[model samples]
Target chain A: DVKVTQSSRYLVKRTGEKVFLECVQDMDHENMFWYRQDPGLGLRLIYFSYDVKMKEKGDIPEGYSVSREKKERFSLILESASTNQTSMYLCASTSGPAEKPQHFGDGTRLSIL
Target chain B: AQTVTQSQPEMSVQEAETVTLSCTYDTSESNYYLFWYKQPPSRQMILVIRQEAYKQQNATENRFSVNFQKAAKSFSLKISDSQLGDTAMYFCAFEGGGSNYKLTFGKGTLLTVNP
Candidate 1:
C-alpha cells in the first residue's frame, strides 16, 4: 500500500504569522501537489512539483509557495497567514503517466485566528 | 484548457439504494482520462473509478461504476447498494492523459446515505 502523510492534522496560527505545512510520500512518487479545499470551491491547486527542486504554480497560487527540496518531501508555505487562508490543505503524489490514481495525504486543517 | 463540472451540490439516498452523480468536462484534447474520487470525513481522496477517453467501454470497480460518454464529454458515477459508509463528498477529476498528470477537479457533490 502507498502512503502520503501530512506533518500536522490540525494547526492553529495567528493571523499574519508564517505557516508551514509539510507532506511526505513513502512511495517516492515523482509528482507531488498542494491544494487548499474550501466549502464550495472544492480542491484548488496551490502548487505542484514534478521533481526535486522544481515547482510550478497552480491556479490559485497567489498566497502560497511550495518547496520540493527532496524526493520524499514537499512543503507548502503560507508567508503570512490570513483569516481567508483558513481551510483544509491536501497533499497528493503520483508515480507518473500510466494513468495511476493519485495517493493523497490525510490533510492538514489550518485555522488562522 | 480543461475544466470539470459537477452540477449537483448535494444528494441523498437510502441504504441499499442506488445513486448516480453527474460530471461533465470540457477539453480540446482528444485523449484524456476521467475519474471519480471519494473524500469521506477522513479527508483523504480515494479513487472510486476511472475511465480512459479512448476506451469505448465504461469502467467499473465492484459496486462503483462509471457511465462514460465520450462525444458528449460526460462521465457519471453510479453507486449501487449504497451504505452509510458511502456518505461523502464525491469529486470528478480529469487528467490530460499524457505527461501532464495534474488533475482538474470539479466542485464535488456531497452524497449522504441514510440508514
Candidate 2:
C-alpha cells in the first residue's frame, strides 16, 4: 500500500506567523501536489513538484510556496500567514501519467488566529 | 481548461439501500479520465472508482460503480447496499491525458447513510 504522511494533523498558528506543512511519500512517485480544501471550493491546488527543487504554481498560489529538497519530502510554506490562510491542507503523490490516481495523505487542519 | 460540476451538495440514504451522486463536466479534450473520490471524517482522500474516456463500459468496484455518459459529459457514482461507513464527502474529478496530470475537482457532495 502507498502511504502519504503529513507532519501535523492539526495545527494552530498566530496571524502573520511563518508556517510549514510537511508531506512525505514512500512510493517514490515523481509527482507531488499541495492543495487546500475548503467547504464549497473543494480542493484547490497550491503548488506541485515534479522533481527535486522544482515547483510549479497551481490555480491558487498567492499565499503559499513549496520546497522539494529531496525526492520523498515536499514542504508547503506560508510566508506570512493570516486568518484567511486557515484551511484543511492536503498532499498527494502520483507515479506519473494521467491514468494514475493520486494517493493522498490524511489532511492537516490549520487554524490561524 | 477542464471543469467538473457536482450538483448535489448533500444526499442521504438508508442503510442497505442505494444512492447515486450526480457529476457533470465540460471539456474540449476527448481523451481524459474521470474519477470519484471519497473523503470521510478521517480526512484521507480515497479513490472510489475511475472511468476512462475511451472505454465504452462503465467502471465498477465492489459496491461502487460509475455511470459514464460520454456525449453528455456526465459521470455519476452509484453506491449499492449503502453502509454506515459510506458516509463521506464525494468529489468528482477530471484528469487530462499525456503529461498534464493535475486534477480539476467539483465542489463535492456530502452523503450520509442513515440506519
Task: Assess each prediction's global lDDT (C-alpha) against the native.
Answer: 0.92, 0.94
Model 1, span B17-96: residue lDDT tens: 99999999999888888889999987889999888888999998999999999889999999999999999999999988
lDDT of 2 at B25: 98
Over 4 Å off, model 2: none
Candidate 2 per-residue lDDT, tens place, B31-78, comes to 999999999987799999999899999999999999999999999999
Cα lDDT tens digits for candidate 1, A23-92 = 9999989999998899988888889999999999988999888889999999999999999999999999
True contacts recovered per prediction: 0.57, 0.69
Q: What iRMS does model 2 reach? A: 0.9
lDDT of 2 at A104: 98
